[model samples]
Target: MHIVVCMKQVPDSAQIRVHPVTNTIMRQGVPTIINPYDLFALEEAMRLRDRFGGEVTVLTMGPPMAEDSLRKALTFGADRAVLLTDRFFAGSDTLATSYALAGALAKIGEEFGKPSIVFTGKQTIDGDTAQVGPGIAKRLRLNQLTYVARIAELDLAAEEITVERRAEGGVQVLSTRLPVLVTMLEGTNEMRRGTLEDAFRAARTQVVTWSAADAGITDLTKCGLRGSPTIVKKVFAPSARAEKAHQIPTADLSFEALAEAVMGEIFARQPAIEGDLMRFSSGQ
Candidate 1:
């Protein structure tokens, strides 16, 4: 069995800043980390590899710095890593990203065998949109399992898998086939530390880097910003509302008198509310 885990390098939210001129994220000098949620997905994939004795591949698409995340994934025992970076892939929305990633996965299948499974985080903190995984699945025609909490069973010989999935207000037990994509829930498992051997291997390892063309993509128009259906026409912070809550003054006589005075002022301001209160008391 082989598993592919999609990871992303993201700007640490604590250090995120917007560029004044272009109205874009100022990533320069901003600390970058693996998408927090993807760490769990990577860890889970590693755990599965440890159990079933298979290979785990870490895949990512971003700037050159994204190679760092792939190396870190190798430290966690992933057997291979691939980086998809190109100028043409810039400004890609979810749809375009999914297309690029799917193309890369296809290349991987031709080069190294088809991965039995693919894992992704539930959502990216920067985008906060959980559409890429499903989009990739649709393109690859792979079974998709989102918000998976656990891998209940796996029949490698039969190419079947069963998992526990979390849905709105409930848990769903789903069964699917191999070549599936699973979006892992956060905290499903903990990340592991790399041993000395793992660290050395990661440091010297060269991840397979490919441009959009090398990934078997020919149509330049159906990539990056051009392929994205949704566009952010503008980005601006929300303005704060002006005004403060009314302050209730205290009475000199006693605490109860002050409380009564506050309530009385509010009731006086809205007589209809007092009428509704009376009706509620009468059980009508």
Candidate 2:
């Protein structure tokens, strides 16, 4: 029961800034952290490994700096970590990113034992596209379950898994066999703090770093920006609105008077809202 958890390192959204001239993200001075959503996936994977008695391997594709994220996963009790970094993988879009990740996964399977399940977050904060997980599953021809709320059961001998998937209307209970890819939803579980022993082990463990060639990626054309068809013509922040919030003074007013004043202000701003409230009160 080998489980593979895929994660990414992204700039802290609170500290991210846009370049004024270039209209691009300013990564030079921004601090980086593991994608917040991916922490849920990592926690789920670790939980599964703990219950089923197996090794969990964390994998990522990014610049050399991404090694920090992998080591962090090791501290959370992952058995191993793999980093896929290469110059050819620069400026990769979701398609190219998924292609590279799928190729690396193939190599990981060959080097270690084949993973029964591959897990990832629903989306990345940087891209916010939520496409890479499904893309990887498509390229690898694996059954994909996205937005999974909970894993109900796993039968190792039977090689089957059951999960409760979140949908637009409600939750859907689905069952699938092994060798599947799952994108976990946020809030599934909380990430655990590393013990002193685990922290020491992570500090000494060497991360397995691989180039594109090492991951068995044969086609260079399908790797980086060249393989990406989507082009960003511009990136800029939206302008702030000119309107300022109006405050109501309640110090001198009674509770009823304050309520009336608040309602008057609301009606003044949007007259149609009063009519809607009246119709609802009348049960129209």
Cα lDDT of model 2 by residue, 114-189, tens digit: 9999999999898899999999999988899999999999999999999999999999999999889999999999
Q: Give the best candidate by lDDT.
A: 2
Candidate 1: tens digits of C-alpha lDDT, residues 147-197: 999999998999999999999999999999998999999988889888888
Worst 10 residues of 2 by lDDT: 231-240
Report how far residue 198 has shifted in candidate 2, in Å: 1.3
True-vs-predicted CA distance for residue 231, candidate 2, Å: 0.9
Local distance difference test, each candidate: 0.90, 0.93
What TM-score do all the candidates reach, one by one? 0.86, 0.92
Best-fitting candidate, measured by TM-score? Answer: 2
Query: Which ranges in model 2 have alpha carbons more than 4 Å from their true place?
Result: 19-22, 242-261
